[model samples]
Target: MWYEILPSAGIILTFMTIPGFAMYGLNKLVLGNGYRRNMDLRFNRMMYQRDMRLTGDPYKQNGLNAVDG
Candidate 1:
């Protein structure tokens, strides 16, 4: 009973995830290099800010003070 349902559920999940993955890959492929570079830069900055906050680095400030500077 349960065994019969597992393959169908797996196939359904695969179908659902593949299109979104393909669209993401296609966007990256079609948008060229500049967009990708900008995205990478933004991601790095976000990660750095998060790390700084976690480590309580005063020099790596947050909030309006950081942006105002």
Candidate 2:
């Protein structure tokens, strides 16, 4: 019983880790890109903020078009 449960637990843990790893890679990419281009961290942050604001509203923004399935 314990041996069977261990495999399931490992699989569950792997699923959680995959997302976490992907997010870490994405964060590194965004910051890394700005760094290589000589842009300051503040500038990078501002750009991300602007994009979020532009896409935040489900009605006024592109949120609806983004989820067409």
Highest TM-score against the true fold, candidate? 1
Name the TM-score of candidate 1. Answer: 0.44
* Clashes by residue pair, model 2: none
The number of the candidate with the highest lDDT is 1
What ranges in model 1 sit over 4 Å off? 33-69
Query: What shift in Å separates residue 66 of candidate 1 from its native position after superposition?
Result: 17
Q: Candidate 1 clashing pairs? A: none
Report the C-alpha lDDT of model 2 over 1-69, residue by residue, as the tens digit: 668899889999999899777866775687542122323688876755665566753123354565436
List candidate 2 segments past 4 Å from native.
Answer: 33-69
Task: Report how far off residue 29 is in candidate 1 (Å).
Answer: 1.1
